[model samples]
Target: MISSISTNQIKYVLALEKTGSFSEAADLCFVTQSTLSIMIKKLENQCNLILFDRKSKPITLTKEGEELINQLKLIYQEFEVLQEIIQGTNQEFYGNLRIGIIPTLAPFLLPLFLNKLVTNYPNINFSIDEITTQEITKRIKTRELDIGILSLPIEDQELIQTSLFNESFLIYDASGTFSRNKKYKIKDIDVSRLWLLEESHCLSSQIEKICLLKKMDTSKHNLEFKSGSILSLLELVNMNKGLTLLPKLATLQKNLIKPSYIFNLVNPIPAREIGIITHPNFSKKRLLDILEIEIKKSVKPLLDKTKRIQLINPY
Candidate 1:
């Protein structure tokens, strides 16, 4: 009877992809060059396809090999997860939790929670990737990430979202360019003078939704920042006499000791729904619950009185 493909053979192919040469792949795997080559040949024979172009000096994957390599990646990821489950059943939350966080949320959010998370759960290792919102959603859907932290309205029906809390956006007008009004609407502010983070940040999307800046022209003086930390951006606004949006968490951290008048948005105040997302098949319920609890505890003391006044309840 034909045996199924072994993980070792699969690993050999992955190593070859990385090293680009059989000799190097063998060194990485701690095996002889011929052994690595033979195993790859065996895999090719079993699949009845030439995995590598033998004529090529550096060795490139054939079209079929390229496809096979992609499948191998998925398979390897599954294997690691399965192994983690088996090993962790009798232990602590003692495995790598691969997570993706959007660039907008990473700076302020992680600082508040990461220290306690590491100290409390030493076994729960983290492999975090800071990516765009679209990439985070894609990774969560594909099971490439164990969880994702992002803003709400993730339209994928297959994934599950657990709302953490809502972080309100407060207007920052350091140069006193924006009129000191207790309540402001989108039309009240000069669109040209408003500084905003560049596109790809989910905050930009949320701000666009609130201010109706959909097609409004903005000034080139508004620096195009990639992150939504808003701390440095607020500093720039203070120095340069422009206005930008600040998430409650960003304003609360370290700096921002100046006296600036804060205004609230009329009616539906601008807020981003912070939440954790996971796939339906993820089975670490107890661990995730503890993580949620820790996040809430860490986040509470940092919120300002105004930010707390309009609590954006999570859906």
Candidate 2:
């Protein structure tokens, strides 16, 4: 009975599952809304199962529909793998690659390798979304995103993580609270005057762990501001005479207000492991290999190698 179903029908069903709205799903599948609807209805008739509950605001799958969709996702992933294997044999590289990166890493890291990567492989269309670690993980699992670049180690067992490099955290002290000549220890930092990204960002959690700020009162500072951008955090830190922790790459931005404000941690230096993640069944081995090599090469010279380091988990 399954042999009667066409691949296009499967594609439409999965697209609808990914996007609840019929119009949105049609856009993804590059078909008219009516065409997509009819195809899905035909699929439902063939299977003799009421798949989506159309009465719902944003259409939702029934219990049986959910189970079938799970199997369909695995089957579609295999289809992707087969296509990638066939494409690998060809010398020309051309495909759509969707990537999700954590906001903390996106700005600093993208500049290092993205431009060259795009220019070198004009045939491959690249789409990047700067999002949180949780969103990145969710998108990768759903096959919405082809790859993720973020801090390690994510606890999800369904994904594969490849370590790229270890980036140490640095003190961005606009308050002159710490001497420039000395390597600052965690105990040296005053929690009261410390600034941080909003709690949603994984970097903020990692920084809190590194400094053991969980038990301390972070609201003791004169001003209480939560910013999403590292650039904004820097500006606020300078204006309010406060300090914040920054990943090493963020400190390398060209237009930072004061280069003298950045300070390294005392040994062993607190760091985060930066890496790429993909679903276990991801098939773009060539793209993954290329990205790993380019990113490592770009950051190798800029990252400090002499210090003893301890990794902070983002989760």
Lowest summed lDDT over 10 consecutive residues: which window, candidate 1?
306-315
Q: Can you list the residue pairs that collide in candidate 2?
A: none
Q: Model 2 over residues 1-315: C-alpha lDDT tens digits? A: 645766788899999988988889999999999999999999888888989999897999988799799888888888889888765654266698899999888989998999988887778899999999999999999999999999999999789999999999888888876786776788888877888888888998898898787743665866677778888888888898989889999888868747788888877889999999999899989889998999999999999785589999997
Q: List the residue pairs that clash in candidate 1.
A: none
Q: Which candidate leads in lDDT? A: 2
Candidate 2's clash total is 0
Give lDDT for model 1: 0.74
Predicted candidate 1 versus true structure: per-residue lDDT over 46-150, tens digit per residue: 888888987787888999999789989899889989888876763676787887887667877888878877776678888888887788888877889888888
Residue 124 CA displacement from its true place in model 2, Å: 0.6
Best by TM-score: 2
Clashes of each: 0, 0
Error of 1 at 141 (Å): 2.1
